[model samples]
Target: MASLKSLTKTLGGKDIWMLTLGKGDAESKPAIAVVGGVEGSHLLSVEMALRFAEGIISDHSDVLDNTTFYVFPNMSPDAYEQYFAALKWERSGNARPTDDDRDGRLNEDPFDDLDGNGMITWMRVEDPTGDWITHPADSRIMIKADRSKGEKGMYKVFTEGRDNDLDGTFNEDGEGGIHFRKNLTYEYPYFVAGSGEHSVSELENRALLDMLYTKWNLYGVFTFGPGNNLSSPWRYNRAGASKRVVTSILNDDAGLNKYLSDIYNETVSLKNAPDSGEQGGDFLQWAYFHFGRLSVGTPGWWVPTVKDEEGQAANKDKNREVNFLRWAEQEGLTNYWVDWKEVNHPDFPNQKVEVGGIAPFVMNNPPLAKIGDAARNHTDFIVKMAKMQANVQLVNLKTEAVGKGMTRITVDVYNGGTLPTHTEMGTRSRWLQPVKVELSLGNGQELISGRKIQTLRSLDGDASVQFTWLVKGSGTVKIQAGASHAGVDSQTVNLK
Candidate 1:
């Protein structure tokens, strides 16, 4: 931002403008703005953003000038500190206690690390009437109640421990303050544990919102979270049977789905997917719906698993299972399970603790050994998109020699960034500024062509408008076009 300010000062304050990008813009650029670690445990998100930025700053030059890359290495800085401090936080909120269960108690009870092993793992209680039962096919997994199948559920599954509230609710609300991502107007899992009212309730979220609103040139976003990559099997296959977790259809012009399909398909296999619910206020939806630009959410890492004891190739129908176990072993991700230690919990009197799932710094996060490789691949992707941002285009220009000695000069300004000049009508009503265009004399005292043409106090992609001016005598003029995304452009033509 200081660099932008300095550039603004050098060019006459009029030419160098600073417009907010966020919701109200013509078009956002292909420029990728990454926000990492929305969840406390996911420190890898920060690593991903830093890696991408480091690559851009170090290797790519032309892209730096052409595209504006903004990096918030760790948007959830507070969450990170909390996770590190507690050493056992799997929370996405910022430690704000609310009534997650709606039983009139405000975060009264939550999950506990009963065994004190420095990690929170699932706890199974032997309840005869429990709604969940161990899957017949896989003893390690849990399944929901099924009356039609005549199979009864005997075990209850909770978030690794007993309820702290003492009201009988297990893992309702634990630690942390507030989750900025949940607070945002986008997809908020409201009334659920730590979600505050609107978006940006926490200081960290507010800070990010401030930057996004003020930096209007930001066109595209590549958020690292629960979302999948634009590459591979996950990219190609629709959420299919999983209606709750669906992805936006690809634009016909963007044939990048093939490459994405390969990656997702190649990396992970399906073991189980939790039920999906309505995402009330999602970040990417806000970016796309409000800005009319492409916004993507991607899980930073994935693990493929396999179920074949014979070590045979996976069948067509159950490709996911094969991928999941395969990845867990191949990556050397820790099993964390230590001989099924026996632990007596207030909730479960006779049950054993099983520390399963991809271990810390393993599956969900890249192994320490390959963090560099993960960083390199994503950085390369960011640099590639940055170069693709549209700098400037001559959409339309008209010149007419008036009846006598006057000439009329008309021109249109366009924003080719992936975003719009101004976002939705709501954003404009909020008085967001659109991008502005200007026209002036090339040199000397000659006001022949036109004056400065202004737009939304902000400007986005594919957003453009025209300006015209009537001048006298046969002279020359300069038409300069500028935007927060494309930077600057100037063209000179004779007025004869």
Candidate 2:
């Protein structure tokens, strides 16, 4: 069964819909949340998520027997809609009014579409004081000056904008307000631009957190956004992982990440992906560090290495814009590049300021035609994760007549799947309920030994512990084990 719900509305009054697919309600089975729009600018994520949901509901509902799915396709609809607005710009924040510069002014010094191209692109101002110069590898792209390489600075780069508030800043603050991507509680970036007054302060962030906290059955999270550890898993840094306030992936979690990362690489055709650098207040880290769940993220697409006239991969410089332009040209994608047109700017009255660059949202997002390949492959990969969900089993049950009326009942409470009952971080946080094992006695049965109820902090995959209970005058005893997120199992035994 599937449930479509509007959990909450964004500050801009956009409905944030989450699709719950499972045997029953979303909470009835172990779930893996698929989140999109972590960065409102990455429009491809929303589509990727949508496709995943479609794949499950249309074809792969069999996985629903064990793994439920909670798909939030577009969490930042306010900023996502900007992609289709009259003036397009890469926006990550929502519509709520925010003083991004902390200057007591709201939406001041917004970007200007200088060339009237209806897109906020880059502006290059030629000046000797500038620390940026045209890339030597590709003249059309810019790279910072390298003094040791005898490269002299010749151009200053800024968004196409003017200092509307006379604050000597160009587009320092804009209509796009607080960001759901930058408003998470873990490693919260306090007083940072685009990160609201406090963590989870934005409506979108608060609503998602509220939903996440209530879902005790969630075992993992898969997000389509910029903070990717799916392509290349982050290595365990002992220093960061050992801190009083843990920052890096814990040892056990890092191993599991490597395990999952290998599966991701195998499932997705995209390769040679750059590591998604760390960003404070991102949902990816929060899902692991604070929320205590297995979380993996991917941008879903990136500029592929372009081929030269000889049909060989060219542009080895690794500069994203340079590589992007190379790929766009090879793919014959038009309007993606705003050919550096000379534009007169009031701020740079006496200087040469050219308005041009890659069009907004093309570098991170692929052409709509190419979205299907990635979406399909990613959906297949998410379904493969069902194999890792914890499964409870009662192994090697043994009963002995210890006395005339007393019977010894023993069972091995075990986890049969590859992943532990709880994540390494979950154990550290201790927020999730432990794997519970209980003995339900029959009529007139009395317990003489062992615990009627016991909790195990965690049970690693293929690991087991013996649980024994001595009962007097038992007709039948039921042994039940597992957590809500972990698969549950029970066995009934007949006592003589």
Indicate which candidate wins on lDDT: 2
Off by over 4 Å in 1: 1-32, 82-86, 97-108, 187-190, 232-278, 291-293, 305-326, 349-362, 395-403, 408-470
Give the alpha-carbon lDDT of every model.
Answer: 0.53, 0.87
lDDT by residue (tens digit), candidate 2, 271-388: 8686686578888989999999989999988877655556544566677777777778778989898889998898888899999888898888888999888888899988888777
Query: Tens digit of lDDT per residue, candidate 1, span 1-496?
Result: 1122211111111111222112222234324567666555567877787666666656664564455565555545555554465545455555455666667766656556666776666666667777876544445555676879787878677776666667776777555456555566655565654566555565555555666776556656667665543532223234521344334433321233343334433443332432121254545455544444445555555554345556554343443333454555555656533233457765555564443332333335555676776677666665555554545555678888775667787777766655343333324234433355666654343445456565445444566667788766667877776655445566675776
Listed in order, each prediction's TM-score against the native is: 0.72, 0.97
Candidate 1 lDDT (Cα, whole model)? 0.53
Compared with the true structure, model 1 gives a TM-score of 0.72
List where candidate 2 sits over 4 angstroms from the true fold. Answer: 307-316
Q: How many clashing pairs in candidate 1?
A: 76
